[model samples]
Target: MSTAIDIAALDPASRDAGAVAHYGDPVREQRLLEEGVGLVDRSHRTVIAVPGDDRLSWLHSLTTQHLEKLRPGQGTELLVLSPHGHVEHHAMVTDDGTTTWLDTEPGNGDLLVYLERMRFMMRVEPVDVTADWAVLSLVGPGTDDALKSLGVDEELDEPDTLDVPGAKFAQGTQPPRPSTIYRVASLGDKSATVAKFGAGWVRRVGNGADLLVPRAEKDRIDIPRAGLWAYEAVRVAARRPRYGFETDHRTLPAEAGFTAPAVHLEKGCYRGQETVARVHHLGRPPRKLVLLHLDGIATDELPAPGTPITLNERAVGFVGTAVRHHELGQVALALVKNNVKDDAQLRIGESTAQIDS
Candidate 1:
């Protein structure tokens, strides 16, 4: 298979090692990502294909989402938890009738291995397809227009299957959900295979869409590209908790804001259902994910991820992703003790961080 586009080769001067950090102006790129359309190279993430007729049922029995009735082209998030209910894996999942596609953060090979091991007598086969496919995200309010520019639009043939009913477990706050896959006709003869198989388009936050493009056809599509910095700034502003950053070995799904979209409280037994039920009914998660506004801090002065958060000189939690948002200024997502007041003043280094209202 052809290798994915060398993102650094697109603009070496703006590259940050393997991934592009920005073109020449990240703030401008961030603005474009918010107000206009910004293309993001997400090829660094991993993709796994679980094929076989038993794929959906097997996955539904194992994970934390209701996937047995996941219609083709529809997308959702799911979690794999430890027996004790700590988060072990998280992925953005979509199906294409024959196969279930899971896209997750880099270095999550464990998710693949775990799935493979759990197959048992099931007919499911998990295969890594990252090398054969690439992920490009179109972020901003003009995302639909940008897809139209690429000759891709809504898949009208597929049923509108966005609503998957379940208990509202995250304090009644609805999380951002993935949209149905769209067919891309711009890739010529390869478009049909892309649509029916692995690669296609799925919607994301900021009215954006994630294009799962074949590695061979990556260069065929053209748009103004933004870097990881621009993409992350928007994500941080959205209060979306990522796997490795906001989560650790002991991170529970409820603690990091994954409970609503990724968990089905009424679903049958899965790996960690017991703990999730216990926490929801009898108690609360020890930590909660919160957005912090780093008041008066410059872009260069932002603290790194995993920086300890202190409240009243006591260690409360740790910062996750921090970025200089276009309108929100310096902001971050932090996992703080659940007892920390929403209006509490926290400290990260010498900078003062307050939970955004």
Candidate 2:
């Protein structure tokens, strides 16, 4: 909804080593991925407090992850999809019945509202803990060292998910007792490290590692920080689909390639249960998401988002994203019709790409 973004609004006092640059400026996003090992003032993350006994049941019914399997000091990634199975909000949930923190995009306020409207008889209470806290995320090579630098380190072989008043870590190796969440996934060379917490403590906690925040407020100053480009680069390589871009109001979980984690096929029923079950078990989905490699350069430029991709001049699908690669050439993610052969020749804008089998 925000058409124009003031880049510096992300992290004004940004200090990152080996940061990426675009248009002569440091791509502040490095704080989360490339340099996930550095300090960040993630003061904008939204935190929701769900307290009460039935909290687990209340959330299990709404999210995609299996809550019964999760223990305290642990967190899991989830997607709260619409009844029709379109992604409403991609979320990460952490709780063991006492309290749960929901971290999601700022645009998805409806999630909080929806939970409130439905909390009539449930003993659980959903409260917005945002004003009370701020969070920072780091996702790269030196995360462990950074945490150790902060004196938040533990020697557990299995990265431990810690419980902070407003924080959680989701993935890493042998972290500490203070680490709220931990996860293991395929990043570029090493997996990513995503940490979440309150906005107010950005400086107070990071200072343990001798890291300091030069900014006083999250909304008052503009930080030329990270955005979707850098975020998606690591996301795509991890085969993760972002909400609005890869999954949205019109797209379903299966087609977005998140069925395994987003849907419990054997579970009794859900919003779009019938349709999802039908396509999943009996019928073939109309379209399939596939990666593409444009065969040659375009005369002018590659097609923009939603431009029809053609093979033999017949419409097959559309381009979702195009990333120019130094090693692999121009690669893209596309939602091509199921009929398109794996070896089908493709036309994107004025160039040709292949459907690598």
Candidate 3:
């Protein structure tokens, strides 16, 4: 119910060309993302609880990922699509069997509520547990080493189960000491390691990091420089889809670049299962999610979020997210027509990069 991490103290960075936001602190989003890695206090994301006898089976019938195999201390990402298979929400869940916690944007809360309402007919009980927990994300180059030093062993190559800090769920590994470990295979050069805790300890855990006198003085983990905006740019570069951004109720998985391990086409009948399988096997996607590089696109700059993408003098797609890159120049993720998707030359008033197939 109460936000454990203070957003006011955390900086707010704009998406403007080279902006940055750290731990919530305001900074150049571009610098934060490219030059230095950062920590993001993603306390705002909501968590919903699924409990009861049919919890796994109940959710198995709703979400797009395979739920039967995920154990406690483990988390997996998923796309909750509308019947037509367009993404309605992108979800990451950590389950302990007894309670499967869904972590997603607040915007997706309505969908969770809707699913829960429908669950009234089943044995699983859905409860809003957003107020019950807090989460912090670490990203960028040194992420793996940082986590490995923090009692989490990265020795395991897969998402395995672990019991840590009182939660048992699937994770990437189990060190001599226990903790939940999830893999973030998004960004090209970066990865994410999420450490979660109940609302009561979120603050303590966050604050505790500052006091840790790791003999790791040898491993220069710049925990301080790593913040939210930097992490945002990383997501943009990785072309990792964000809810309410690249995806929406009308955006299909194929069109939004949903190629991650999240969606299991072989998984039997979920709400949008019919469309998911059909599209991958036989149907052609209407649009293509692309990464764009702009060169003086706008007299001022490239448009943000909803700016229309123009190729060959016609509107092809919309700019999902745009940010200035330190080295790569202007970069963006756009949704263009499937036909010209990869062939189209991106032209934002002259700035351009050919889409690579």
Candidate 4:
């Protein structure tokens, strides 16, 4: 059978955070994701496993989420904050009965070092499993069927799947429920894994699953996959913010819509809790996350990141990400001043934009 998207000339150089830019027509691949299903290779993303007894409570004391109560087979995301409450790292976590699995973005060496340094006396041991594991993404409507075809079943224990809680897998805005993420076998024979595409950890995103496998085996896993460019378009369209783009060293958890998924409002005493509470009750973040609909009247392309958003030719904010939506022609996400009126019409270059409800 033919692969869904052919990427014979896929430039190994044009990568975003080390993942391919596109297989072929990013537009068609994106359309396939929304209407049916598509695959994405996420091996560039990293995975770390924390083992031992003190793992839960120790990690809970450091990050922005309440992970002390994270049960086996359940998954959630958290952010590590600097002492000043800036978001330093983002981790998607899942706990098996024995170990806590953490999934993070590419170029996470600093995150790993920080995590290891914080482990002075705790029984928890942070292991960088990136060398031994790889991650793949099964995106869109038919992900479950694709997994089944590749031997992912409840009865099998080799490949584990963690459907991210609150990730919208179906075509609606309804809240998502946690599902059993199968834990498959370890990485060994490269040829065998490439042929089967099994034996890895899977995490659900807004519309699909992110599969993790061994890094060395990545080249052998010849599968049709979408790239970060396509994924970012849909993600921005969904009003979801990413780590490197929407957040940074100066970002407070609340500033990037991290309040729900990455922060617990009532959770006690993590590194950034005081700032989070202070902002939640007394002050507003200097800026707020907003989705902007770029005007198609004069231009077909969306403005690039860092493009100034202006009102009456006065700068109000800068664009974070912009993409051509499958339905909504041109869209972008911006962190505008909180005082910017909700109905304000802003301009990006010569094109106008609006903050939508």
Could you tell me how far off, in angstroms, the CA of residue 318 lies in candidate 2 after the best superposition?
A: 3.1
- What is the C-alpha lDDT profile of model 3 across 35-59, one tens digit per residue? 4444455555666777877776676
Per-residue error (Å), model 3, residue 125: 2.6
The best candidate by TM-score is 1
TM-score, candidate number 2: 0.65
List the global CA lDDT of all models. Answer: 0.75, 0.52, 0.55, 0.68
**Against the true structure, what is each candidate's TM-score?**
0.83, 0.65, 0.71, 0.79
Off by over 4 Å in 2: 1-47, 129-135, 155-228, 294-305
List pairs with backbone clashes in candidate 1.
none
- Judge candidate 2 at residue 295 and give its lDDT: 55
- Global Cα lDDT for candidate 3: 0.55
What stretches of model 3 exceed 4 Å from their correct place? Answer: 1-20, 23-37, 153-222, 341-343, 348-357
Candidate with better lDDT, 2 vs 4: 4
Task: Report the C-alpha lDDT of model 1 over 218-286, residue by residue, as the tens digit.
Answer: 656667888788888988888889997888789998899887668876677999999987776655789
